[model samples]
Target: MYRLYYAPGAASLVVHWLLIEMGQPHALQRVDMDARQQKSAEYLALNPNGTVPTLIADGRPLYEAAALVLYLADRHAEAGLAPAVGDPQRGEYCQWLLNLANTVQSPMRLWWYPQDLHGLPEDAVREAARRRVEAAWERLDAHLAARGPYLLGERVSAVDFYLVMLMRWTRKMPRPGDAWPHLGALAGRMKARPSFAALYEREGLSEWR
Candidate 1:
């Protein structure tokens, strides 16, 4: 059986949703990040990075949400969450998944914790990070506008999960909806999925709506 260590609201949600989509039997261990449970020796041994959403399968631990989601999808190809190796859309699928991590995800992190990225006080750096986030959101909005539904057309690939969680982070920012209509719509669609609804219910997250 696979074991998934997760913190509520963390990138681990991507893995959790994927596992549920795949219909995999897994144990979910909630690591309390606020309590520093992730930094404990046992958790660190599983993942030295001490990050949630770590997967332990076959006695091996896998970190990083994107990697875990892709691994689960590939392992259970019958679930149809991942494109086959030779499929034409495979390239686009991989590209957008990684792009979400490298481009959209990174900028959101900067906005969330500006002091960590800029090595300055939040008071001194928040505005600069917010401006960068706004510019990034504008670019994301335009891209989504051109693409229509889903990052890669109609199929709900792993990229959607990443974007769903990332966009949720944006809702707390000033005027997030006003700045990015496409992203807001995408988030709404993601939340509408039964899988996401089940996850929210299981996680006891009343704020998902």
Candidate 2:
């Protein structure tokens, strides 16, 4: 059995959703980040970064959302969240997976911790970072618009899980809905899934609305 350490509204939601979709039995351990439970020695032993969504599988700890999803998909290939290595779709699948992690999610970090990325005390610089995030959102929105439901059309691959988390994070920003209608719709579709609803209820994530 796998043990997943998670927190509501965090990237852990992606792994949580994947586990549900795969119908895989796993333990869900909620870490209270506000209470600093993630910083404790016990949790630190699991993940030095003090981050949520740490998965302990076969006594091995797996951190990072994209890596976790890939690990789960590979472990349960019958789940169809990932394509076989030789398949043509597999190339596109890997491309989008890396794109989401490296391109999409990385830029959004600046908006969250502008001071950490650039120095503090400059309203103009903050606004510039916000604009950059918005621009990235536009690109994602266009990609979704072209692809039609899901990042790869019909199949809800691991990339969809990545996009779902990204969309949720973007919703909290200023002018939230201005850039991505398709992406927003994708998030809504994922939320409507029974698995997502069940996880939301279990994790007390009703505040997501």
Candidate 3:
């Protein structure tokens, strides 16, 4: 069994969702971000970065949300959330996952906590981050329009789960991700899954549902 250290609605949400999706046996330890429990020495021992989602798998601790998603998908290969290693679509799978991590998810930190970009005006940081995120939404929407109901086209995979989670983050943005027609449709399709309902219930998340 795995032990997942998480904070409700944080980046850890994706990891927790994946565990639930894959029907993996796991337990959760909620890190109180508001109380700075994640920064406590004890939590730091498991994750130096003090991030939510320090997953204990096979008696070893692992972190990084995207990595956990990929790892879990690979571990539960029978679930078919990822393309097989030699499948033609495998390259695209890796590409979109990394793109989401690098292009979209990285800038999200600035949008949420602009002060972290020290020495820059918070407003300026937020504005730039917002544009970057919106541009990603536009690009993804076009891709969906041209070739998808899912990111990889015909099949739903781990990437869709990851994208849906990120899309939910944009729900309150000035120009939300779902404001794009194709993106809105994709969001609707993903959120309709029973696993999503289970995820929201488990995380105690009511918004963007």
lDDT at 164, model 2: 76
lDDT of 2 by residue, 1-209 (tens): 88999998788988988888899889999899889999999999999998888998998998989889888998899998898889878888888888878766776766676676555665665576668767767877888788767778888888887777776777677857334688778878877888888777777887555
Model 2 whole-model lDDT (C-alpha atoms): 0.81
Report the number of backbone clashes for model 1. Answer: 0
Q: Pick the candidate with the highest TM-score.
A: 3
Q: Model 2 residue 73 lDDT? A: 90
**Which residues of candidate 2, in runs, are more than 4 Å off?**
122-126, 177-179
* Residues 26-128, model 3: lDDT tens digits: 9999999999999999989999998888999999999998998899998899999999899999999989999999878998878999999889999999999
TM-score of each: 0.90, 0.89, 0.98
CA lDDT, every prediction? Answer: 0.79, 0.81, 0.90
Q: Which rank order by TM-score, best down to worst?
A: 3, 1, 2
Report the alpha-carbon TM-score of model 1 versus the true structure.
Answer: 0.90
Clashing pairs in 1: none
- The stretch of ten residues in a row with the least summed lDDT in candidate 3 is 164-173
Task: Give the top-scoring candidate (lDDT).
Answer: 3
lDDT of 1 at 14: 84
